[model samples]
Target: MTVRSLYLAPVTAVFPAPARTGQGGAAVYEQQRNRTSDADDSAARADRVVELLGARDEVELALKASLGGLPRERDETLARMAEVLQATAQGLALDAAAVWADMPERVLRNWLAKDPAFAAALRSAEALAGAHGLAAGPATTPTPAMVRVAVLALSRGATWPQAVAVAGFPVRGFRRLSQTHPVLAALVEAARRARPRKPKNFVPAGYRPRRPGQAPPGPRAFRLVRREDQVLP
Candidate 1:
């Protein structure tokens, strides 16, 4: 089974809420979670996703195993593998992010060696991911990788464009990188210390800094209710 087939189903699973009836005191039911894939099947799928994420490290060897015999005859596998990796990244949160976090340059290069689509996508993705990784930094003029990473961070509310302030870039490069790189940029953005922020309309005009052990506001919450008569017969 494809890695995409395994993890993506969960993301689409909406957070369930208590179902309410519209009229006539009808029974209400929450939307059901997909159970077609059993626990055993899910465990198996998770294992496969882990394997593929690791395979990215030895992409050449894995590609050789998947389509080595076909070589030029089989080009679709490259796209298939890339698609799986991308799906795992977007759908599965912890596992997918962890898998990619460990992905290094050496492993990616190894994978790119065997397949042409991977070779091309890797080159593009590398430029994007790498540039993004760099852009997550404090650099003003960064490599394409940084720009890609920045866009990804911006997409997720992690970082702001004004921080880097690159106004002009060519469309040929296809900064679609933002859609791809957020999972990593978030980490980089989080590491940066938050600048000392000024209080914004928070404290009142006469707001006074309370000293330790000082009196504080009280009665934030109160009850207004009455109990019905429960006299026993």
Candidate 2:
């Protein structure tokens, strides 16, 4: 086959252009092609977003499973403390978890300070949670300070890796934290919605880069400037 025939054969077989009744028919075909292309691009973007969300959910479930069980206690108050410890291990705040367990926040604090067995239980809970990638120590939630740092970095246009580095937190930990704290998730969404700023010296295509200390070229007003004897004033 000829070069022109070879080129047109595959394209015609794939697209199968409609019979040309007039210019309007061709215009309609073009519009349909453009619409189909746009729809496909939108679908691809949506799929990527869904995949990211699914990955985050998987990470959270894995972390929860790794946390194991809370220490058993005999007394009612100690049982309540165990409940609080479980809640906190799942990334809830200390006071919120205490309230969730139907215990007063002040009373929980008093128990931790005055009771030796309770303190020892607290230590055991911390070790268990920490072994499973949860935050340990006095703070209850999973790396609230690191989450704050990451949020701030993300707000300033940093990407996930950069934000995680700045926060000095693991990616899985950050994702897990976001699952518990709706406010942190909302802040991250807002940061994503914020438009990225372009560089100050951006230039369009067909333009040469300007030298340092030189001003930018102005807009073209005259089309005939390229023609012979058409001198720019």
Candidate 3:
């Protein structure tokens, strides 16, 4: 057989390709780029969420450590309350946490009052929430409704729950709002100090007022009356 040489054409010469320089090509490129950017953004957000959750977990651990040396039942109760507080800090409403925990909101409030550890945990959780931007912050300019509610809270001598109930507002929302808002918190504090005070010259009911410079009445002697039904002892 005679020697023969075979030549092969370049792949690009054999298969001509369309140019990708028109609006259609640009549109496809832009779409793909947007998709990649969106995916990256989603991943970053997921990582941030995980970091926040881990921080919350650390708060819980610290809370548990603080609750040490308590009675078993009390420790459990405080732990539960801490969990509720953390949930609230993470955007769950206080009333909703109460509902989820199958208890009345008053119980939670009372726990906060009676247990200092629980209260501390609540403060920590709230601070964490604020730091992490999880909790709502004070408004730049409060709305009319917010002002009205705040005024109502300030004007009442009743407890927060009672005042909020009378105002037809949810106690949890009002409490959270007041805590986050400086003006509202100040108003609430003023309301707390607004308890009725007695006048300087006030006298007890059923007691006669003494004349000026008159001596106060002395203590009376006690006398026992004999019972007719009792036999002589």
Candidate 4:
């Protein structure tokens, strides 16, 4: 116990710098990835999203101006810019949705319910809440108008909501009429018992012919699988 003790002093002399070796230059490897995210874009992007939706400007301007300096905007120049812009605007392009002109009324209706800005537009229009009566659902399964629309829509090839709108019934106040119309009750019973439609065969995507501008695809384009008047093979 009266022996010696080792000093805990630090080593001051540096070793040969270890030949400056450690998996080569990790700096270059780490820098390989692009670290830019949308958050890094100009501070005005939020304003741009709202502005584009309101100004009703072409999507190209929105993409170029709003997404300026972003890789997607640059890469999109070579492809179908409209399609690309549209996809980006679907969920995040809150205001741009107004420009989806071809979207059906029923689809727009549902979207308005889910989107606050769109819902605000409906509120301003004063027709958003009960416009389709779906929020309340139906205490009873279906009313006369609902049944009529349902059968017509289902039979004539419309979506459920499409039939609801096309038949022109107040979805909310429908119960009021349900008691007045017995046929509607019967129609629901019929619809509930009716057979469901079969799924149609799909046209393969890659099956193009050698010739360009060949007379456009016939009835298939119109979704007419086989008409009685169609010339047979």
Candidate 5:
């Protein structure tokens, strides 16, 4: 047989183009879809496995452990911190709690940073104390000394942190105090709003309104110059 006849002798020859709109075409499309879905599922499963094996939780737990002996449940410690913070909000001097529970300020700060619930309790206590005017000492009476100092500092153009320091209150504690002592806060705000007064002599000397003796401007005469009288090159 000739080369052309030999090449054509095979009955099962491959086609140059792909099949379309038939069972073979449908099968190819379904296979492609199945492969895409399988790839997505595998990627998701891999991510889940990585997350399960991650050490992020372990690292946080280790850090918390290094902060010394915080209460295991957090409730008791939170209660104690709340008591102190509540007093602060009621105008009890924040410095009065310097030796809170015989724990140093650094230790208390560490606890505040590590535990979210403890921080939240502190906020709640401050709010409650502000609303109720609960004092820090056993007397539970609000004091004017500390708030007055803070107001004075703020009125003198001190930053909030500086004012807080002058008043010997924690930053959040001072905010709570402001809530309880709205009058002091308002005074501080007013003082801050007090800008340098515009001088009585804003306008130059001899200007109208500022210089009442200055004569009103005279009306100008509108005499039109004739084209012949105009002096132009």
Candidate 6:
């Protein structure tokens, strides 16, 4: 029986690390240049794909808007918008609204104006997001803690929408909750008038004449409380 030992050159020795001169250097340079070209090509392709996808999304949104392709009922739309606005973080409601509803901020704003519940939800969300430094955005699933915070905010002069911003609950859902807990609705309603608003058109209360440069005595001129003679529920 014969014993044999096989020896193999190490990769470093066989390939002999490229020197910074002549053929070795030229080969290394060519390899690097090819890699750079390939990378540039890949990057360009990726950018083109991204651009195309973005354009497709824009086109789809435009078509949907023009065709009134919203899938939910009007009330449902409002509720969903409220939920997204409430749950989303600050500085992101506009983007969130678009993503959630496939509608532009301008269109959503128009709806918000016409829908008190939606407006309230948005305002509440903004309030909560600002207060908690949660301006980045909403969680995927709203926690019970978030709901509790929203409820507390509502009780503390925050509107339903504003309070529920972090709750991820819909406006209608909050309304239903309010029904079971009347205090919630009452508190929100009361908070609405907690601060007096200036008279419209700069007209003073009791139709009194105002002098030029007068700021209509500010909001303090009028009391927010109802009169004693007014009937109570």
Top candidate, metric TM-score:
6
Residue-pair clashes per prediction, in order, are 9, 0, 0, 0, 0, 10
The C-alpha lDDT values of all candidates are 0.37, 0.53, 0.51, 0.36, 0.49, 0.49
lDDT of 1 by residue, 1-233 (tens): 12233343452354343455564323222223334334335445444533443344356545655743433313333344465345232332222222233332344445556556645644454355445442222333434433333333332233343323321223322233334555333322332222223346566788778999999663232222233343111
TM-score to true structure, per model: 0.19, 0.28, 0.28, 0.22, 0.24, 0.30
Q: Per-residue lDDT tens digits of candidate 3, residues 1-233? A: 11112244543464333377788876766676665555444444433432343244356446655756423444445456756774656544455455333345787888778777777877777777668655533333334333333343333334667655433456777777777865556445544444334348766788776799999653332212223442211
| Per-residue lDDT of candidate 6, residues 1-233 (tens digit) | 01112244444554455566789787876676665555444444433432342244355446546656442244345444754674454434454444343344576767767777667767777777778765544454444344444543443344567656634556777677667754444434433333234347655567866688887342222112223432211
- Count backbone overlaps in model 4: 0
lDDT of 2 by residue, 1-233 (tens): 00011112233454557887688988877786776565444444533443343244245335544655422223335446777676555444455455345455687888777777767766776667667776533343446544544554564456877666545556777777667865566556644544245458756788876789998553332211113332111
Off by over 4 Å in 6: 1-31, 34-38, 41-90, 93-102, 131-233
**Candidate 2: residue 115 lDDT (0-100):** 73
Error of 2 at 31 (Å): 24
**Model 4, TM vs. native:** 0.22
Q: Which residue runs does candidate 2 get wrong by more than 4 Å?
A: 1-75, 91-93, 136-233
State, as a TM-score between 0 and 1, how close model 1 is to the true structure.
0.19
* Model 3's TM-score against the true structure: 0.28
The 10 consecutive residues of candidate 1 with the worst lDDT sum are: 90-99
Off by over 4 Å in 3: 1-72, 136-233
Model with the higher lDDT, candidate 3 or 6: 3
Stretches > 4 Å off in candidate 4 = 1-150, 157-159, 200-233
lDDT of 4 by residue, 1-233 (tens): 01112232222231122344466544433333222222222223432332333233355445555644433422332233333233222221222222233223454546556656545544433333245442223223333323433443433344545445444445544445545655444343333333244469676888756597677542221111212432211
Residue 199 in candidate 3 has what lDDT?
Answer: 41
Model 5 misplaced regions, further than 4 Å = 1-86, 92-95, 133-233
